[model samples]
Target: MSAARRRGSPAAGLCPAAIDRVRIRCPQDVRRAAEALHAIAMDHGMRAAPAHNIADKHTPVDAEGNNLAREVFGWSDRKAWCGNSRIALDSPITAACRFESEPFWVNAQGFRTSLPNHYLAAIDLANFEARAMTRAAIVVPVHLPFGQIGAVSFNPLDPALTELDDLFALQGDAFGVYARTFVASYEHVMGSLQALTAAARLSKREVECLRWAAIGKTDVEIGMILNRSRATVRFHVYNASVKLNAVNRSQTVFKAAQLGYISLAS
Candidate 1:
């Protein structure tokens, strides 16, 4: 284990006071929590942005989509691509999402020379975006056991402000801890809030179709199970997808489960 792990999570005690002041029951609460995290990241001389895989799913396609997962909270000055760019497929932020543990940093030049070759291409892609944003970033991946995954990115306004070495030397452990705790709390409370609010947006039939779809039922199969016409089942599923702003069957199932309209569990 790294010293950070041996020493225990530094983020554990960093934000309790600020987090205690916010309620995660509403969108406003989420925003406030984000602000608190940003403030914490700033202590290390970098601005903070939070990105979520709101669907609670992560795949290359998920990052490649028009929306890079979802932008639950972010810095106003952050590059549009940082939150909504399809180019994220090759970005280091997406790469961080795949790490079992440990944080990753990417700068205008590239990822640290120590990163293995398999991780280089993604970091190369991230370097292009980093240059565009005039910043270098480090991401703290947040992987919750219940299928929620996300990250908090800390970026310096100017790539030259400090070397990646200094940033990591000074605040690496704090970044990991804060990102993990914040993302977990956000998902737990937001999951409940979405369950209540999102249900009202989906009709009973829509929910039924989505639940079935989540379990690997094809449209025709779903129709057969529900004794409805295939076209009818497709219609309900399409409507649910549209309501959730989902782009495909996989995303549709993911959104349904995230909002608590369906469960993909055994």
Candidate 2:
């Protein structure tokens, strides 16, 4: 079926393919976006399931060691394989990011045998679990600055839907575009929210220091601008980093921007 015709499916309401641009701001929006991507896959005669994002490296595992996929996508009859697997650390989605810094596809066969050569034997047990749970996976890697890395993954559930190879060959670029756009929008909103929440605790002096830093001013230069001693400037910057949970000056500035506390353009 043609992409447009396939998108005519009612499920496409969750992921309207005709829309050229969108701003996804919440989980519901994400689900809609995911659904749309899945529709795109189906348009190419691929048997597909709902699309979902894998948890990033920063996401914490649960007490039972479950990742965000189970929670974010929520549980459904179609999601049994994911919930059964329970862990994300060595799953195919994560491996897609590990094996390459770019978007990639892994089929059932690749799931069974793909691994770093050095740990082939030692990692066999982990690989076995992944192979069993994930029959096929297409991961679109999103790499952002300051060590943020993640992916949007599509898992085909219906046994009848099995054109993954052909889908990748024909529509991979389109899939990557949708995945990248969604990931970027998600990160922007969440990062802003997190920064805003943390920025509330920042002192006035800290904000000043970070603003100057954002504009490329050095500690000594910032001191000159503020008529404070260099040591005092450094102290405020350090304190700001502490308050922002940032590891360094650059991160402090970046966090401040994320929170809308400072503008880099100025």
Candidate 3:
């Protein structure tokens, strides 16, 4: 295990007092907790976007109905941060977050992750400046249950600063803990509906079928391996797709893997 995981507290670098202040229980607590993290980020010469759902266009709002992005980071331009805009679709920073769970810094040059991810390199950074808006940022990805991906990015106040290597090194882990805690708590308290339908449950046979399908097994091939008829295998797979609300066979397998019904690794 990594040293950070080995530690008792995920918020290793933060004091207990600061960590306590970062917890959110109700919608009212959202702004308070976000401010606490914003203060910590500012101490390190960075501005915080306390909570952001990468897939959503609207930024998360507190009880008082203040937009966290505008209130905390002072970014008035909503489209610049996130929306159905070209920037939202083509941002390298958010793209990197999709591949990387750990904290990573990015600039116009490229992404710097704890582990080398060739996936980040494959992302087109052609209009990085125009898309990403910031010159550079230290991003913490918060991958939540049911495939919801949240993120918090700390950008340097100075527009001229494009490099965040030193700042990220000093504060990446702490930022990660704070970012995850704030976003996760906020989501738990504020999320109106579950990502999956209530009927989204699979049977043993369905799981068995998906496990085989995830590894590229055809229905006939899976039936041969599982000692079932191809028609029976198809029935289980189709039932699994209905439960998962998946449109196609591939989506069925993908959602099954996401919900832990089947292991894609296996």
Candidate 4:
């Protein structure tokens, strides 16, 4: 079933009864909890993936066999019992691991598949070899557009809860809702955190000058356009370079552009 696009609207094809009984925990806390999720693994011997950013994962692996965390989510820090771990950006779990036990995220084109084994680490593994993890795991698939795939995994081996699929099936909607709300809150927190970081914030003039320099403009030319001396223009550019921690003017411009302090286009 397709997730409803309406903000604050819970996805359709969910149990109203389960939702009503379900209480969404602190979303701010939940989003922050993506870090140290290992505690959740330790708490119940079950791992939980709160948000999986697929954008960074849509690439080749690095030396450590992992991509930048931006692939799924960022600003991930452990708030409670969660930690830094994301699901496969393109994996079978996207569909096969839905709350409804149907394809969680699919379209007319095809299924978004990823490293299936990694995504389903906490999922059922009777057939595949089970790695030593917190005894159980619960995975809630959260699908967002713009190639954003979010899933919250929870494995609570609480003896009181058994019949894995049945129990998950029972609480699926609540989990889905929690996943939805948490993603929204997570984005907001990131925006704020980014703003809080201390770094030289460029003035409009400096930003424009830096952007123009990135296109191979000379200081004299840039100064003539801005009605400033080349020396003054160079100073601003140099200050920006320092803030960006670049070794040279070109590297400074590149780093500044990457951080989005200025545009690279001339």
Best by lDDT: 3
- Write candidate 1's Cα lDDT for 44-103 as tens digits: 667766555523333111111322213323333245444444534545555545653566
lDDT of 2 by residue, 103-152 (tens): 45555434222123332223333453244255565557677643456566
> For model 4, how big is the CA root-mean-square deviation?
12.1
Off by over 4 Å in 4: 1-200, 243-261
**Alpha-carbon error at 262 in model 1, in Å?**
20
Pick out the ten consecutive residues of candidate 3 with the lowest summed lDDT.
1-10
Judge candidate 4 at residue 165 and give its lDDT. 44
Give a tens-digit lDDT track for model 4, residues 54-112: 33333211223342233223313342112313324223343344323322222222222
Error of 2 at 1 (Å): 31
Off by over 4 Å in 1: 1-28, 54-74, 112-127, 130-134, 192-266
| Model 1 steric clash pairs | none
Q: Which ten residues in a row have the lowest lDDT in candidate 1?
A: 59-68
Better of 3 and 4 by TM-score: 3
For every model in order, what is the number of clashing pairs?
Answer: 0, 2, 0, 27
**What is the lDDT for 117 in model 3?**
75
